[model samples]
Target: MPQVFEFKLPDLGEGLTEAEIVRWLVEVGDVVAIDQPVVEVETAKAMVEVPCPYGGVVTARFGEEGTELPVGAPLLTVAVGSEGALGPVGLVDSGSGSGSGSGAEAGSVVSAVGSGAGSGGAGSGSGSGEAEASGNVLVGYGTGAPVARRRRVRPEAMAVPAAAHVTAAAAVSAAVPDAVQGPVAVVSPLVRKLARQHDLDLRQLAGSGPDGLILRADVESAIRALTEGAAAATPTSASVPESVSAVQPSRPSVAQPAASSAVERIPLRGVRGAVADKLARSRREIPDATCWVDADATELMAARSAMNSAGGPAAGPKVSVLALLARICTAALARFPELNSTVDLEAREIVRLPEVHLGFAAQTERGLVVPVVRDAQARNAESIGAEIARLTEAARTGRLTPAELTGGTFTLNNYGVFGVDGSTPIINHPEAAMLGVGRIVPKPWVHEGELAVRQVVQLSLTFDHRVCDGGTAGGFLRYVADCVEQPAVLLRTL
Candidate 1:
């Protein structure tokens, strides 16, 4: 018996009601296992890859890739055994056992079939079993819908607007697809990413998605051709460093001038849009102040260097400077609980957190993603380092879930990697404070009237002044400096 399961879109946070399918990793007839990523979903903030929850053969994708699907809407259909047939993208109230998108059609409201458990019927529309016919699958199963194949009729290159012309309002007001079988396929995120990478005009590339949707593969194929042509013309003897490779003279400049007429309004709908809102809210709602201090990290550096050099069989993951800092900050927060609190405007009170959930700021292609390292105070330095490594990779690949990105009480942004001396980083919304670590540079310091070169890093602390006073913020910075100055102290704190 061929049993089928339906996978729907999961609730991505921050009041996000829906997401646009960005790409499809699997296709109909493709066999997949539980937790295998099948679709990529582009939320208002980032592109997230959804994994499979139930292992089986793919039957139908309810919503076409590049189509905007409501949260809890069916995205994919999988056949576990020979029990039932999965329906189409758009729903049909028809009882003919053939839902070929010819009934009361709406976007993502596809009719499903199953045994008369009432669990399997036509157009249940509710996001529930047969595996929540139109809701997000578990984290292991990926998010978003399958991208449909589109065929171009004419070169409608000049029909669509430029990237600069698109806005959130425009996106919202854009024509909705009236197809009975899912919304008309639009440009996939993969296509957009590829287009940006190759400097290709998205409007010019005809969509290969269902109902003429443009997919990433389409853009990639075009980019590959363009690159191959360029490579054939150039000689292999000419090489340039990747860091400086972006400085080509022939590249067209996309500089936006400062005049009202000169500036083209780009809509804040996705990652950039979300970032703007969060930053603005943080600035307006939370009163913030920054304090800076320099710490001598010579011993810490020596310890780390020595550990790396004497690498025998280690018990756990290696400790990193970031991990050490996080552990220290978590401990310090225990002393000044005010520093680990968030303002609840709705509740009209300050919520002091009992445990420290550290949000490590990670830079991604889709702006900054802060994945939380929960219960940082309880985790050892080695465990914290491992979590950071895992989350960083997940963020980059758009595999992070809403839970992993939320519920952090504080944040840590690393500027040392960029060789920055110090900076006042914005507070991640709801968090009371953020700690910035500057580059560890050797400089002469006055010790007992004698100048000595020491490895020093500047610690910049930005805090929500509304929650904690300068005295408390200063104390937290001092405590962090002391821990970094004496790396051994962290072990005791942990």
Candidate 2:
């Protein structure tokens, strides 16, 4: 007989609580290998393929695609051991059928069917025992040795009234057909909920997903079709008598509004929602001040071009203007360390971070996300550029992990790509300050006692006034501006 094992949705880590089913990789009666990806799910952070730690024949699956399930909800059940042992008993619910004597009798039949081959197989015990699972933790399954629990069955306990037994058998028989007749081909709970709310029968609709699996869109289409059909069948004002129509106008002309389909309402969830909450909290908690200075970036641009052009085949990644600005920010932070720290309001102390985990804002289709480059103070301009490029690609592809998006000591936001001159960037909450770089364009400027067209850029720094006074903020901004005006000035610290 085969022993059925249930697998629940495991924690995907990074404080994520729930995930929506994106796609299913396996189907009922399919044989799955240990560590095989069973389903792909999308969390608030990223899309991840969850792997099953147990290898067996898939017995059942829960939830449909697009349904959000909380952590620890049963994902699926697998029956392990030989195929012959499964028999008709395997058709029962794997998760709900192991408690009663009759259910256990059916399970015993399944176990007996597999005992022939399982007896000699490695990791298999006596026919009465459960099959062993592979000790692998793909998403927190096999972490420790299984504790044995003995359950004793008494014959007297099974002596219930015949009517009661018949009632119980009828209930089991009724549910068995739904499980064994054929897979429902549905994976999302949301789709089922929507159909229930509209009083639509799911069995009547055709599925659109793989293997005729039902999807949320299918349910929604069904709803729209029913609604439109009903609206078309109903009588309109044309069918009303002229006497009634004329009397209706006199009674305060109450009109039924037509539904508009032009507007789209996107839920503020996931990345966009996280950003909104952080910005709102920052505004609520931090007394921030913004200071701006215009600098001649002609030298900085020239230095970057020269560095990129000088190296040959052995040259590293090209240093970007943002990387150069990041290098300057690190140097400026070193001179004024107060700006590179967060406030611990309860402790009444400013927590100054040692290593600079610099976060740079990148705009993607998902929204604005800050991908942090750890130990930025130790990395040079070329290194910073390479990391920024790597993180930017990840952010665009929505492959950035939670750790990559957090734990920044300071933020560098370059809004120049949008052709903006400057912005008072909100402090990336808890972080003391943010440096904003505007578009570096050719503008007339007085340089070296002469007026000329120089590449000038506006640099804005928004700092938490609670952490540092205006004098400190001004000094930090001045150092950054000096680096922008004269790239050679950075050599003093380099």
Candidate 3:
């Protein structure tokens, strides 16, 4: 007999509470090595492939793709205590499953399974004895010990929208097959999850799907039957409906849905949910103010062109406008350090930061993400530009780590790429200020006291007023604008 240890969804750091199963990498009875990716989950932070810590035969898997599971919920089960423990990615170090993406460390848990309890959860693993487990499983978090509690499945976890239910029901009715008895005709893992939640035995209920496939409707119907029978046995006094049955023929079964009243419900999860929560928190906690100014970006443009055109192929990577602006932000923060610090509400003290971690907003296919450059104050424009390009590519490819997305002391949002003039951007929470740059275009401007056509751009600064007064914020914005107009002013700090 093999020992079965259940693997639960490990907390992928950054205070993320839940994750949706994007895809499953292993199936039941498949041989999975230690530190092999078993499932890919999408958290509020990023999409990560969770590596299983145990090396054994996969016995069971929980939740379907698109099903959201709370942190600590069971992910799958592995039958260990066998020979030939394989290392999928590379060398496994002392029970740490450090072979998959980011080298996730799965906890070392060894629990002997009985004859029929292969799919038992954490608590059930130690049915008759103590289940000893320890160590971290995720990138930055874990129980570090065996902490098994009875799992309570939330109703909303397995909830399907009314529209989806109707659609599934329609699909079931449209298909009918010959009555054939074979393996369990279950197409969706969600139906199994729903049944487990309600404690309804799926084996007892007849499926209505084609080829007798056990669908969600079948589980729901069985649950309804149990609920109705339980309610009837209670002998509760109810409102009499004896006369309503005779009049039922005159009335329709259900009110027809109004064509205009149809609605599609979209769950705000993953990246979208994270953005919403952060923006809302920033609005609630920070007293922010926005100030805008139009600047002459002609000189800045000329400088970038010259630098990129200089030294030919030996000039390395071309400097982006955002990188130059990022460098400018670092210089401005040195002078106006007040806008670069966050407020400590509990102590009510303003702590000015020494180094500047510059964050810039990048719009990807998923949503808006801010990838932070570790230290902009220490890097030149070329270095900053190269880093920004790297982070942007990671954002587009959805490979940015949580550390790259966080720990920003300041932010630069270049809405110029969107062809917009200016925008009062919501300050990224915990960060004190954000500099928004609009598209630069050739416009008539006063050059050397003469009206002439020059490249002009609009810049907006939104800062947490609690951290700095309007005067300090204005000074910071003005210095950035000055650097744009006269690139030589930035040379002084350089």
Candidate 4:
């Protein structure tokens, strides 16, 4: 008998308590190695691929994709020492063997690596001879290992007809209805829910998916058949042909509403929900005030171009405008440390931070996210640029961990990317100030004692009034503007 170990969702840091299942990487009966990511989850902070710590055959999954599970909730069960794990029972309704599909049986073992595990030999997926516990995994996540391969089932097992197992499971389900739903030939919980909503007998319909797997569209078609047939004939009359009506669903309660409910409700539970909560909290607690200044950014643009072209052919990666601006923010923060502090409301005091964890806003398909660059004060422009680029890519791909998105002392939001001139953005909660940059465009300005068209940008500083008076905030914004208007001014800090 294999010792079954249950793994719960680990504590994703930064005070995240729950995560929504984005996708499942492994299915039941697949062999998994220790520290292998089994499911990708989206938490309040970021998207994370959670690794299973126990190496063994996956027996069951707790929640379906799109379901939210709280921390410490059961994630999956692994049979750690089983000689072989039972395969999913093949299921087919009484649909004349048309779409009946076959899955591996209980006596077979699936392999995780190469073409070898397809043979179903005992004790596979461990990489070693036997399975073992995971080591050196960062809490809640693993160090990036080679990506796990999907397990393969035996070819011969798939050739056998599904009816044999269906009849057997039918008999077994008679006695143990809870343990087996005949594996149902349906993989999606949403499809199962749809079938249940209409009380449809899944055993009667042939699946249209590969190997007779039931799909949402197939279930929906069944529902439409029942609905159309019901509407064509009154409750007192009419009929469907035996051949066509045989597969038609018996239930009709969920077909449609007499009235159309036009309102579309989108649940705010994931990234969008998190943003709402944070923004609300920031607005309620912080007495924030905004100050704006327009600067001639022509000098800053020229300095960036000169720096990028200086080394002559091998000048390395060009420094980005945002990166230079980040460096300037750091220098400005050093001059005015008050903006680098957060108020400890409970202690009724302001705590000045020593190191600058700078966060920059990035817009991604998932939503707007701020990936923090750690110790920005310690990094030069090139280093900060590289880190920013890496974090931005990770954010876009939804691979950023919760830790990378939090712990910021200040934020730099460049709304200029959207072609907007300015925004009074909300401060990220727990942080004291945020710097907003508008688009740098050619504009008429007074330069060198004469009016001329110069590359110009709008800079706005939104700070928590509780932390400091306008003097400190204005001074910080002025220094940053000076640096942009005259890049050589930064040399004093250097």
Candidate 5:
């Protein structure tokens, strides 16, 4: 009998529960050596290629590309020893028929990767466990048994009341059975509650869940009829509209006031998800403030265009306004060390980094991705421009790695891309500040004490007040403006 061993996903890092399988380097019937990179897993942090723990023929693969698999779940079953370590096929659900084995049969004897030698046989139903539901991940090989634990609840509880009406409308349209006994159809939890509280008939309300269904608003409107008479009697003009007092033309009655709720439901995922987490942490952890300034960069623009025209040694990736702005911001960070830091929320402390890796936002079809320019402190204008070009291309091509996305000490968002003047852009969380760049437009400006049309831009600096004050933020922007106004000045500073 061939000795069979199961490989389970290990915790990649900090509280990660699952990872998307990118590719498998090895295939079934292929001989593999120990510690060989057999598979690649893409986590939120980065893409990690995992090494094989044992030398054996690939017996079976249990996951597919882009499928998020829970850590501690078996990845593949490898047979040990000489005579082909093939065991019964381990099935995995990949939706398409392309995935391997039907997984372990219920009551079939199987050992999980982290489970010890003395594990009880696999007891299966619909495979409901922490391995399937949790987002915590396991990344590497370990000999110990899996930790037994219960579900982890969120620190803050989510309230349903605020969205009850919306859900009720969806449910009512879906035709889910409800206890509404009237002409109006029952919709959602909130709608049901509203109707019962106001003594409105639910059967009469139409649903709006999936179809043109009734919702909480339908129920709320029914209750409104009773109270509206009393509200109209009040003397406040805001309470009673002018039309209500005027002689109105009689029109055909509209269909029993179909539910008309105006609210947008956006899924909290991807960029939106990251934005929410960062904003919440920033609010809970950092004190932030803002500073603004107007900069005349005619000389800067002239120099940049001249360099690009000559295609000189300094020439690189069509010198963009954002690239110039990034150079200025990075140069200023050297002058103000405190701005390039993060706060330890637990310890209530600030951390100043030694170098700058400016996070430049690149908007893509998927979402906004920020690929950092590592060691921005050491690079010059040309190098910065080239690196920015490369990183931006990679981001747009969807080829960015997780490492490229992390460790940014400061961030720069160019709203100017969409032709906006200036606005307070949210600080990419944990980073003490984020600089928002506005459009470069021709405006009247004083040059050598004479008024002239010059390329002018607005810079908005939004910083964490907990880590920096208004003065610091203002000084930083002033320094940037100085550098851009006289590009040669950077040579002295560098």
Candidate 6:
């Protein structure tokens, strides 16, 4: 007999707690190799393919596609052993051979119990089979060498009475009367949370899953029933006697109800939810302020075009406008380090960071995300441009990892792509400030003591007021604007 190893969902890291199953790569009874991608799941940050460490035949799968499961929930089980050692076992309903039908069916339940007993005896005899531990230290399992299996307790040795099984089955048809009478079989924390929110006793509800495991659907149904019952029990005004009525209008006028058909409700979840939560927290905790300035970008645009035109094959990637702005922001932060730090409110201290981990905002079909470029202060415009391009592509493809989406000391938001002139950007939480760049368009400006058509852009800086005063914020914005007006101003720092 093969030893069955249960593989739970691994931590996708970056403080993510749950993910929605997007697709399954393996099915029940399929052979899988070690470290092979088993399933694709969409977390709050990105879409990730989770790999299984054990190489074996898939014995069971827990959740269906599109189902949201918390981290550490069992993803699947694999039976590992020598080739042809473990024959195909029906896995739809746990060692029970309950057939692919309703668990409430009497014939299926009886067959499942009988088959479980027989399998238990077989499992006991083959307990000496060798089983190796996959050396991968993931969310649940740890690394170790292969070890000989211990004999499993036979089902016959600790079997529940057949009458008890019948009683549990009968409980499925009728509501459980007492909450403390028996154990409630529930697996998902989300299910428990829902039950707790509604003050519904799980013990008083029979589960529809294998071994009477309470599923989310079961709890939802119980809540629905309770709601309908309460609504029905409420007395209506029409039932009151005319004699007991306080006062009645001779002619009652009915007001027309407002139309709700035009309203659309989109669930705030996944990337959108994460963004929403962070923004709300930033607003709640950080004392933020925004300042804007218009600058002549004629020199900056010309410099970029000239550099790209002069570059040969070995000259490397062309610098982007956003990269130039990012580079300038880094220089500005270096001169005014106060704007590059976060406030440790609990400690009642302001942290002035050293290195700049610059994040840039990118909008994807899923939602808006800020992908961080590590050590942006050390990178030149060319290097920063390349990284931004790579992260943007990954964002577009939904292939960015959680680590790539977090830990930014400062953020550069280029909202110009939306054709906006300026925006009061919200500070990316924990970080002190964000620089927003608007579209660079030709405008009539006074240059060199004369009015001329110059490429101009609006720059906005939103900083945590707790960390810096208006003077510091104003100075930082002025330096950035100066760089835009005269690209040569960056030469001194370079």
* Stretches > 4 Å off in candidate 5: 21-42, 46-56, 63-67, 83-102, 106-272, 311-319
Across residues 1-494, which tens digit of lDDT does each residue of candidate 6 receive? Answer: 35667789998898889998666766644567778788878889988899888876654566654457899987877666553243213323121211222223322333332222212223322212222132110111112223232222121443334543354345322321232322246655456546654656565566779987878887777665544444455334344333222212112323323333323255576788899999999999988899999999999999899878885664667889999999999899889999889988889999898999999999987789999999999999999999999999999888999999999999999999999999998889989999999999999999999999999899999999899899999999999999998999999899
The stretch of ten residues in a row with the least summed lDDT in candidate 3 is 87-96
**How does each model score on lDDT?**
0.63, 0.69, 0.66, 0.70, 0.59, 0.69
- Who wins the TM-score comparison? 4
Candidate 2, 1-494: lDDT as tens digits: 45567789999887788887766776645567777888878667665789888776665566654457899987876656543342221223322211221334333333333232222223233333443231110110111222132122121332223433344345445434442333345655446546654655555466778877878877777666644544555434444333222111111222333435323355565667778988999999999999999999999899889888886765767788999999999999999999999998889899999999999999976678999999999998888989999999988876788788889999999999999998998999989999999999999999889999999999999999988999999999999999998999999989
- The residue ranges of model 6 lying beyond 4 angstroms of the native Cα positions read 93-263
Distance (Å) between predicted and true CA of 35, model 6?
Answer: 1.4
Error of model 1, residue 331, in angstroms = 2.0
* Candidate No. with top lDDT: 4
Q: In model 2, which residue pairs have backbone atoms overlapping below 3 Å?
A: 1-110, 1-111, 1-112, 2-110, 2-111, 63-187, 64-187, 64-188, 85-113, 85-114
Two-way lDDT contest, 2 vs 4, winner: 4
Model 4 regions more than 4 Å off: 82-168, 171-261
The lDDT ranking, best first, is 4, 6, 2, 3, 1, 5
Task: Kindly give the stretch of ten consecutive residues in candidate 2 with the minimal lDDT sum.
Answer: 134-143
lDDT of 1 by residue, 1-494 (tens): 23456677877676888787676776544557677787888886567778778666654565544456888977776655322332221112111112332212322222222211121224233322543343211111111233232211121211212221232113212222222223224433545544555555444455656766767666666655545435455434145332222222113545434333443345565666777889999888877899999999888888776655665575445678888778778888887899888988888888898989999888887777889999998887778889999999988877777778878999999989888899998899989999999999999986558899989999999998888789988988898898888878766655
Clashes of 1: 35
Q: RMSD in Å for candidate 3, one decimal?
A: 15.0
TM-score of each: 0.63, 0.68, 0.67, 0.71, 0.61, 0.70
For residues 350-429, write the lDDT of model 4, one tens digit per residue. Answer: 99999999999999866789999999999989999999999999988878888899899999999999999999999999
Worst 10 residues of 1 by lDDT: 89-98
